[model samples]
Target: TSIPSLPGISTMESLREAMPYFELILDSGCSQRARQFLCTLLEPECQPLGSSVTPPCRNTCKVVAEECSDFIINILDLSQIFKCDNYPDSEDECINLARGDQCFSKETSCGDGSCIPKRWKCNGVLDCKNGIDEVNCTTCNKYQYACESKDSCIPLEWRCDGNADCEDGSDEINCHQEEEMVMHSHASPCPAGELRCVDGRCITLQQICDGNKDCSDGADEANCRIQYKS
Candidate 1:
């Protein structure tokens, strides 16, 4: 069900508790699409194939969020739960009101008024009609790997070093190496108890998996299981 949805409200109790916050938004009339958007999340229409509930379109979420940014962020204190960037920008099978074409959150607009997923921008493939998405884009050199999330690149050795050097974690997503094997780069000699990064940087054993990228290549905090203190 959409109750235990992407915001980590995983039970009926949590959904009930969160209802008042949404109700406030409904009462405020912050955006025209707020009611429909909120209802779609609350009681979703199920897909026939896998009984999956399709989420609201990223554009719809973006529209509402932009119009109601002040209320949602300052008053209700709900920016963390209402991140529009979490939604997919693809127009395929997602829920959106019947309107003229427009760009939404996590999407980039082509020069010819067409919208493409933001991830497709600067991906080396020409997805835009006028190629504006690729224009002025930062191309990574041979020694660097381009990050799909933004127009930036990290060192080639940073990929799959157990740390997410790329902001979107694309560098660490499909890594094939084991974590234990990845820990030992063997590139440089450390002072007895430290691990050597692929680029010859040394970090202490306590720094490993400690929720911080100590090494420049991010070998310190790779494959971590982030959890609550309780």
Candidate 2:
């Protein structure tokens, strides 16, 4: 098993004991995500540095839990041992399998029910499952305003004008002066290079795309593009 497995099973004896659980999943022909998730935790990728071990992302575990719950939990009677929340969701890097992805508070969405890191949104690659992250990366036309949802382009004058031109009502998510002031005040408390959440929480830039919501407003992970870096 991996050094820091969710189950804390690091010894070969423990791994052999866990073999039955994995065999059941393999025999069931579960989704690739589920299979890969189990394999990653049970037999993680070989890295030169032990600290380089990459655990499965929490979101991926959640997906697998939901997808294979009936089999791994109900049918296999392993609910007591295989809870998905045992894994770390953030504060460090982990393996990411972008499906059923949810954005963090104040974080941008890919307009297709998936969320990514702000830096990855249009860094010249398609990170969103539907390629929405790369769309409209450029500024809208002279007369148009880019919607907060990043899925639509509308007339600039339509913004904050009391009309709902954007489908997500994001055109007015921050229309109140009090809210802007709150954002500004909250921002002041955060150190430089750190993102201030809508609720006044400070998070590191490294935490942005680690597949977790560090900010209550979810701003730390908005528009994160998932791409292989060279």
Each model's TM-score, in the order given? 0.40, 0.38
Superposing all C-alpha atoms, what RMSD in Å does each candidate have to the true structure? Answer: 12.4, 13.2
Which residue runs of candidate 1 sit more than 4 Å off their true CA positions?
Answer: 73-80, 98-230
lDDT of 2 by residue, 56-173 (tens): 7765665556445546644223453367576666636777644356654434577866555544555466756678777767566645655544556776556557888877664453
TM-score of model number 2: 0.38
Quality of model 1 by C-alpha lDDT: 0.62
Model 2 off-target regions past 4 Å? 1-3, 6-10, 50-52, 73-81, 99-230
Query: Worst 10-residue stretch by lDDT in candidate 1?
Result: 221-230
Give one digit per residue, the lDDT tens place, for model 1 in 1-230: 44543455666766676678788888987666678778888777766976667777776676567556556643232464568776666767567542337665556677565565566677566766568877888876656766656578887677667898877786675343224534667755676545577767766543554446677767555554321111
Which candidate wins on TM-score? 1
lDDT of each: 0.62, 0.57
